[model samples]
Target chain A: MSRKISYREAMRAAMHEALTNDPRVFLMGEDVGRYGGTYAFSKGFLDEFGPERIRDTPLSELGFVGAGIGAALGGLRPIVEVMTVNFSLLALDQIVNSAALYRHMSGGQFSVPLVIRMATGAGRQLAAQHSHSLEGWYAHIPGIKVLAPATIEDARGMLAPALADPDPVVIFEHAGLFNMEGELPDDWTVGIASAKVRRAGKDVAIITYGGSLPKTLAAAEILAADGVEAEVIDLRVLRPLDTATIAAAVAKCHRVVVVDEGWRSGSLAAEVMARIFENAFWELDAPVVRVCSEEVPIPYAKHLEDAALPQPEKIVAAVKGLFA
Target chain B: MTRKTPVNQKIEHRPPPPPAGPVPWDKDFALQLLLDMLRIRRLEEKAAELYGEGKIRGFLHLYIGEEAVAVGALHALAPEDNVVATYREHGHALVRGMPMQAIMAEMYGKQEGCARGHGGSMHLFDAATRLYGGNAIVGGGLPLATGLALAAKLQGETRLTACFFGDGAVAEGAFHESLNLAALWKLPVLFCCENNLYGMGTAIERAEAQTDLCVKAASYGMPTFAVDGMDIVDVHATMQKAVAKVRKSAGPVFVEFRTYRFRAHSMFDAELYRDKAEVAAWQKCGPLHTFTARLKAKDAKGGKAKLTEKEFLELDKRVQAEVAEAVAFAEAGSWEPVEDLLKDVHTPEGTVTAAPQASTKAGRAKSPAPRSGRRSSKPTSARGRR
Candidate 1:
């Protein structure tokens, strides 16, 4: 049995289930309670869960995020929501310095079981300040697990496991995907590791995640019309890049194209391509190619923003160039 | 051709003298407080010697002149409460019951250290004592302390979280943010500011627009206290009341202990910022000798001696012996092996049940999995690439 639901609904349902299931789990962030969520993800959560569980924090990212780390250390499962990745920079010191380094620095005496959720990507014309995908930067950290939920099922399932994790977990939800509608399987179960092969094919592997998944899949559909079958791999977990699945896809397709929303230089796509080269260089038929955002601050102009991002047309061109 | 610039006038710096009063504590308790101060003084003195000898390396911020703050405030808290301190936290760790041997071993980077040789002098952590960290960042521990109190409030725990930082941290954005958050949430946190006058070489007057730190905290709408940090009696009395209010009301409180550090900021700093006379003036009011003097002061009206000079020497001798034992333990402690360097980066079983797909790989690798979860497929060979 399956039902169609929006990504926002899926995420809200997951948080609701978590709150109902565990007494230790509480949500704290700016506008999480009275203002609902920044994206209205927690619209009625305040009334449903009460003020204590659905906490509305002051505009103190460093304070609340560090508090979340402390709360996790002091024995509470905290779901700290930063409105967007751009604003998370205010709390980056706490996230990178204290939350990520505590367990290792303490020699295993403490583990921060904290889940920090933030909106990412640039398609809402929010301009340079409010938009930008920095999930790739977070993926570079060693002490944290980074997740990007592109599908409704993943949005519905990733929260439970992230909260269950003993270390810090950062979840990046694409800002453009909140209203994206998809069918979620009734028994939607997902893990925090490994890449899931959304659409299996044998010609070439189209590896993408988060906001770029829809664009890459659309590009694959166009490739399919032209009789060039492309395997679509949704990298749900980004930190420990499911190399085995990636290598397997590389072995089968023998060609890979990475699509990312982050800028070209030092992007997660660079890392993905580097890993593919490291693990499956012998299996590859050609060099792995990538389609990333242009090197510029995301502009607010509609055409300029569209051009700055990784689109289906651009992904198709990159895949076609690979065959050429 | 260059123009001649006007010379700026230099300002004079002078610290206040120690408070004059009879010893408030009984002979035994006063001796105990003196003993605690001596233990820290002796331990860090040995640490300085060891640093000179190349045995203990890294930034060593001694609490030589600010001993009364840690000694007084820490003793006022319950054992169940949490403590968070700054880099100059050897005194805090000792007073909170972390074995001196383990602290010395940590400075030695030995395997027997509290942090297993991972964190040096700046990052001591003890889970049993509920000591959160030896946080090195200026304003880093404030938010952590606030969060710990938030957890306690939410979980209905009676324990309070006491966070200690230097005057320098008051200039940080994290300090203001943490204070506001703690006050807004009404969390039970005791913010202890050890105002040692200088952040590295910059004086509080030169760095902050408002030198009154308690006012900065008070602006956050929490009760604030300014106490004479050199007097252990004042620090302990103020902390007792502060802790009581926090535990009773489950709200935040701030205390500014007007203290000073006698030594250079770190091992490398030169005492060029302030005059030698200024240092001598603060030394005249040093917590150790001043408190000892008050204990030995003759009541002009003929009261009993608070603490005899003989008892003071006995406590000093005992503290010296303990410090010697700690140094010996550090010398005997071994180094952690290179092979186990990555052991505790993440929890050992972090990937066991969290990732259901990885279980198949674990099975093929013949590794025992910790949690039995829903399996995805019939044991696919991990080696099956093509």
Candidate 2:
């Protein structure tokens, strides 16, 4: 018996299940307790989990993230939400130098089974400071896994497995997906290492993940309307990327376009293109083109902010440009 | 504060000795402690040799002169207690029960190393022994120790965390923050500051405005002590007492092991930090030989005898053999696969919750609603808002 739910509800259910099932699992972050999370994901968590587990931390990312590492070391499974990726920079030392490096550096003696969840990507009218996608940066680190969930099924299923992993894991929830509503099968457990093909087509492959999936799909719909079949592949896992699926898509489509909110320079878009080049270069009819955010700070102006991010029109144009 | 001391000595109070002089432990236990320290000494000596050979690279901070502090201090605690040490912590890891093979492998950058070769000399970690880190960042482990202690306290465990750092760590903000937090929370953490006179090349006198390490700790309302780290007996006794006090009161304690390093700070040092004469003067109080003499004296009082000069020579040969074995183990250990480079940062469970099935349905269903929030829609200009 499957039903529809919002991305926010699915995430809430996962967290609620974790807290209810595991005595050691606890949630902590800014506004996670009383204020019900910065984005309202934990609206009823404080009352449900109480202050001990549903802790609200001070505006000290380094302190709390380091504390999360400590707590993980001390035999607790901690889910630390950092509001967004932009704020996670403050705790980069703990995340990069400490958490990610702990297991391998400790001669494989210790494992930091900790999870850090944060909102990511750009969209909405929120200006430069609040907007941006940086999951690609986190994927660069070794000893840790980076995840980006673009749909409701993923929102409901990633947390439990992340909690079960023996090393540190960072989950990037695209800000654009939280309010999104969707359906869930009664039996669907999404693994963190696989990629999904949303819309199958043989002419062109549209590769994207996180917030850009919707836009990419919209562009695919437009391409289909014009009798140009475009395949849409969703990259659920960033690190240890399921390149097999990407290769399969590119191998069949013959042409590909990568849509991302990250800047074009040294971005995930570039990495995807490189993968296509490595695996399906001979199969490609044209060079891989990417529709990424403009290479500038997102502005405060509403139209400028929208203009700077990947739009449906932009993705459609990019997919069309691939044929040209 | 009440005053009663030899005025000058009052400025630097020595720790009060235990009432029973010291426990008359058997020769086996005594020799075991000595062997552990020697193993560290010889292993580090070979590391210096390897650095010279270019087989090992990076900042190789050897614990050459500071063996007794780790050896004696570690012997005082149970295996269940936690340990947090600095970059110069090969000796601590060995004594805390990390196999010499792993430590050696780690130094050699082999996958079998303590941190699986991910952390070299500066970062040794042992999960079975509860050794928390090979933390390279100055003053980084203090807060971690405090938090571990806090967790133990909250969980109703009688465990304690002993954190080791050089005197230079006193200047870092983490040191003060940890001390205050530990004291305020009454967490059971034994702050063991190895006052080796220098933090890298800078002498403690030059780096610190107030050189009294114990005084700085005492300011946080924690009980403090200063010990002669060059003397294994002093280090062992003072640590034993501090451990007892913290266990009974269940609060934090601070001890400064006034020690010295016989070698350079790292492989690159040119011996310009202090005079060779000063080094020679301190070597006279070398822990190994002097501790042997003290052990013999104590054994003689028991109507038996300690190990003879030949036994000491034999012990050194055995330690050297162990170190050699460790090096071979490290040399032969494998490297972690590049494919797995991204495995453990976060667990593999997160990909499940990312893109929901319903979201896919929603994308396929009615009008697509824009998912929007705090972050900007544009990629290039992402910054965190307060």
Q: TM-score: which candidate is best? A: 1
Error of 2 at A80 (Å): 2.1
Give a tens-digit lDDT track for model 1, residues B1-386. 02232333354456666866887677788887888998999999999999999998989989999999999999899998999999999999999999999999999999999999899899999988999899998999999999888888877778899999999999998999999999988999999999988899887767777878888888989999999898889999999999998987889999999888998888998888888888888888899998888888976678877878887888888888899899899999999999989887777664432211111212332222112112112221232211
Residues B1-386, model 2: lDDT tens digits: 23333322313223222212333567898899889888988998898898888878888898887888999899999988999999999999999988888888887777777776777899888767888888998888886787677557645678899999889899986688678767876889999999987888776656677788888999999999999898787788899999999999999999999888889988888977677777877777777766776665644357654666788899999998898888888777788888876554433333321111111211322211111112111221211210
TM-score of model 2 (CA atoms): 0.80
Model 1 misplaced stretches (Cα beyond 4 Å): B1-11, B299-303, B350-386
Cand. 2: chain B TM-score: 0.83
Let me know the DockQ for model 1: 0.27
lDDT tens digits by residue: candidate 1, A1-324: 677889998888778766755667789999999999988888898998899889999888998999998888887778999999999999999999998888888877888889999999999898889888998999999898899999988887788778877889999999889999998765545788789998999999989999999998899999999999999999989987899998899999998999999998999999999889899999887888999999999999999999999999998888888889
In CAPRI terms, where does candidate 1 land?
A: acceptable
TM-score, per-candidate, Cα-based: 0.93, 0.80
* TM-score of predicted chain B versus true chain B for each candidate: 0.88, 0.83
- For A268-288, candidate 2 gives per-residue lDDT tens digits of 889888988888899899988
The best candidate in terms of DockQ = 1
Decoy 1 TM-score against native: 0.93
